[model samples]
Target: MEGLSWSASGRDIVRDVDLEVRPGETLGLIGPNGSGKSSLLRCLAGIRPASAGAVRYDGQDIRGWSARRIARHTAFVEQATEAETDLRLGDVVALGRMPFRGRWRGPDRTDREVVDAALARLGLTGLRNRAWRTLSGGERQRAHIARALAQRPRCILLDEPTNHLDVRHQYELMDLLAGTDRTVLVALHDLSLAARYCDRLVLMHRGSLVASGPPGTVLTPGRLRGVFGIDAETGHDRLGNLTVACRGVARDPA
Candidate 1:
């Protein structure tokens, strides 16, 4: 995406956002509340049209592609679900196969294999037969991701994917994304997780991009304090992983 902008009710929600996500790399989008992270993801997924600029897929304008073509290239897992469907988990995951299926045709052998593989990858095979509504929050989130993976998309866009997951599951999900060869662009609130898992980070503030680079460079203490209004120190662990520690900050005098 280049200079991508989004608006709702005449208000610019995302302004001139430039991003590039390539295969075999993970790009973490981090920001404080209302910094346009979700809106940006929506634009990238083509769910929300760019009000000002354009989004390109493989050097072609995305506006020239149909919805099905876009779906085949990008899979989106949103932050929340409000649907009341009582479909079984497998059925929900199998919905991803619709794009690849012929009209009036059921899932073929390849579709079934892909669905099953996605289920197993997300550790949801045990609940494949259970009603989606019966699963826990974390389970539901994982199931949504499984559905996205079933699409066999070249890129995945996730919005707060770790929101309802436990610590173990959070790490597990990040590891899963990191190990995949597909491109991943994820909105995350957990700065530590972003730093630990993503190859690059993009920080946003007030609907504009503030920083973009490797975690160690973009997540500096000064940048965090300036954008997040929190004082923090950053360092490396024994394995040369970036680590963050919050330190007390002096309040600004009015």
Candidate 2:
């Protein structure tokens, strides 16, 4: 995205932000609540039209592209999703194939196979027949991810996907996302998870880009204290991965 800006309700939600994600790279978008992460993701996904600037995929501008055409190349998973109808899990996953299917046609063998693979990948195979309203919060999140994966898109943008998940499932989902060959732009609140899994990190603040670089550079103690209002210590864990241990809330220097 170049000079991307989005506004709603007479206020700018995303400023003139400039960003790019390399092919097959995992880029983590991190910031406190109300930092415009969600809005930015929506703009990037073409779910919301930017008030200004452009969004391009494979160097082709997507401003005038159809929704189905965009969905063919990218999949977006929101922070919270509610199923309007009581669709089965398998059926929900199958929705990802919609962009690829003809308007008058139903899912084919390839569609079913892709859906099955997605369900299994997310450990939702046992719940494939379960009703949407009957599943727990975490299950719903996983199902949504399964739906995205079934799209078989080259890129995926997710907003705080680990919100409803347990610790194990959080790691599992992060592993799946980071391990995938597709380009990933994920919004996350977990600093440690972002540090561990993301190849690069983008820090947003008050609807603008604050910093962008490797986790080591972006999640510096000063940045954390300034942007997040937290006093924290950073170090490597036992496995030699970056870890952030927040001491407590930062107090005003007065």
Residues 107-186, model 2: lDDT tens digits: 99999999999999999999999998899989999999999999998899999999989999999999999999998899
Error of 1 at 19 (Å): 2.0
Q: Which residue segments of model 2 deviate by more than 4 Å? A: 1-11
Full-model lDDT, candidate 2: 0.89
Q: Write the per-residue lDDT of candidate 1 for residues 1-254, one digit (tens) a residue.
A: 22222222215788877766665689999999999999888888888878777787776678767788889888999996766888998998998887788888988899999999999999999999998778888888888999999999888999999998999999999999989988889999999999999999999988888899999999988888888888889999999899988776625411
What total of clashing residue pairs does each candidate reach?
A: 0, 0
The deviation in Å at residue 88 for candidate 2 is 0.6
Residue 33 Cα positional deviation in candidate 2, in Å, after optimal superposition: 0.7
Instruction: Write down the lDDT of every candidate, Cα atoms only.
Output: 0.86, 0.89
Please report how far candidate 2 places residue 234 from its true position, in Å.
0.9
Candidate 2 residue pairs that clash: none
The best candidate by TM-score is: 2
Please tell me which predicted candidate would have the highest lDDT against the true structure: 2
